[model samples]
Target: MLKGLIFDLDGVLTDSAKFHLAAWNNLAQELGIKLTSAQLDSLRGISRMDSLNLILKYGKQENKYTKTQKEEFAAEKNEKFLEQVETMTPADILPGITELLADAKKAGLKMCIASASKNAPKILSKLGIASQFDQIVNPALLERGKPDPEIYQRAQQLLQLHNDEVISFEDAAAGVAAIKAAHQFAVGIGDKQILKGADYIVKSTKELKLDKIVAVFKRNNKKVG
Candidate 1:
């Protein structure tokens, strides 16, 4: 049996990725740089500071900004992102997420969020489900970001669960990589074609069936059932 569910925030819980892309694009334009969708996609599941650095490097504009300038640009991007998400209500909760949370809770599974975003708690609060999680691992608490496995490892440790006892839900390639690197089962919530290393891939969070998730764990370890 799976003892816990770890989730990524931006693309998994909220439709904030589009807003992030917009913010990055807008900020890039302000810096006299151009951003491609592919470049924007690579920023998913990364911290804002790391994302800003990636954008600067990709656009060949790293020399254009000092550390202070980078911070200012990143801060401006987040301000825009928060402004856009301010309009989101509980109505914007992802399909099946509320039900999934209720079901998981009833089934005795510990639930937590492990996100690179420093904004994870605020986003969950805005969605009216701040108290749903047993624990939350945000960027603020970690010295390193996703793809490093630190965040997920910390969340598992905080929840008192082993890697096999928890299953992570992710929407981006980097997130999937992090979960796997942490030695946890990962469910990729997006097109499988786009995410190659996930243990299981689903079209959306709404399509996630607990039984199926458990089955994957069962396949990995006979004790999971």
Candidate 2:
């Protein structure tokens, strides 16, 4: 039986990713680092420092800055992003997300947010859904980012559920990889091809149903670590 549900916050819960991209683009432009929109897309499901590292890698100029400077850069980008998202409200909450969260709670499934964003608390608050989650696992407590499983593992641990009894919802390839690495069933939200690693795929939360999610996992019943 499914005992818990862990969600990736950015694209899965809301539409704040655009703000993140804008923030990163602003910083990149200032630093003489030309980042294509495609390159900035990779920042999803990664930690602040990891995102900074990816940007440096894209620019092929990691050797130019000390680790301290990189940290500062990430902070600056986060500040810009936060400013852009400060006005978010319940209206900003994604369609079907509220219903899913309500259904998960009613079904006795523990629910949590496992996001790479360090500002998860603020974002959830802005969306007026902070109280819906049992726990929020951001990048602050982990040594690694999404696609590594550390964050998801911690989230499952927090929920006190076995890997087989837990499942995750994600929107990015890296987030799906993290859920699989954590040995849980994955429900991908987005294009099917990009989310092939997931056990199940739905276009959006609007089309999701708890029965369908459980059915997929039961039929598969396979661990994928």
Candidate 3:
């Protein structure tokens, strides 16, 4: 029984990952490093500091910055990211998401966000859909980031549902791995090859339909049973 849905905010909801990459690029430029698109893509579903470390390692400067300097860089990147997010509005909601959210609410399904971003709340508010979610798992409260089941497990716990009773939707491979590690069904909203670990894959939110998803989940569960 799928009683709840846990979603990853960035790619699954909106294209805020672009803003995040832009901000990270700004910081990298100041540090005399250039970030490639591949490197930026790899940062999806990753924590701020971890992303910074990866960027620094790419520039062969990981050990060059002290803890304080790293913290300051992360803070500066966040300020720029926030500036971009501030311009978001309900119109920015991804295709088919508004309908999906409304349909889920009508079906009495609990919804929550399980994102690596600490700014999840602010992003939600900017999109004007903060009230749609029953909870937003605070990344700060977790000990580990994506690909480690911690955040998704925490989200399931918050929803007061068994692991198998929840479905997690994500766009990143890391986020899909986290959902699978938590023993929940994962619906990947991206290329099939990139999110092969997911139980199901949809090209975009526009392909998400509650009835079809519920049917697929039931069939998958039956096979497992």
Ranking by TM-score: 3, 1, 2
lDDT of predicted model 3: 0.92
Q: For residues 96-186, what per-residue lDDT tens digits would candidate 2 score against the true structure?
A: 8888888888998888899988789999998989998999885776898889999989999999999898889998899999999988889
lDDT of each: 0.87, 0.86, 0.92
Tens-digit lDDT string for candidate 3 (31-109):
9998888887888888898899999998999999899999999999999999999999988889999999999999999
Model 1 bad stretches (over 4 Å): 223-225
lDDT (tens digit, per residue) of candidate 1 on 39-137? 889999999999998988888987887889888898999999999888878988888888888888889999889988777778888889999999998
RMSD of 3: 0.9
> Which wins on TM-score, candidate 1 or candidate 2?
1
TM-score, every prediction: 0.96, 0.94, 0.98
Candidate 2 stretches with Cα past 4 Å from truth are 222-225
Best by lDDT: 3
**Which 10 consecutive positions of candidate 1 have the poorest summed lDDT?**
216-225
As a whole number from 0 to 100, the lDDT of residue 152 in candidate 3 is 96
Q: How many residue pairs clash in each candidate?
A: 1, 0, 0
* lDDT-based ranking: 3, 1, 2
* Each prediction's RMSD to truth: 1.6, 1.8, 0.9
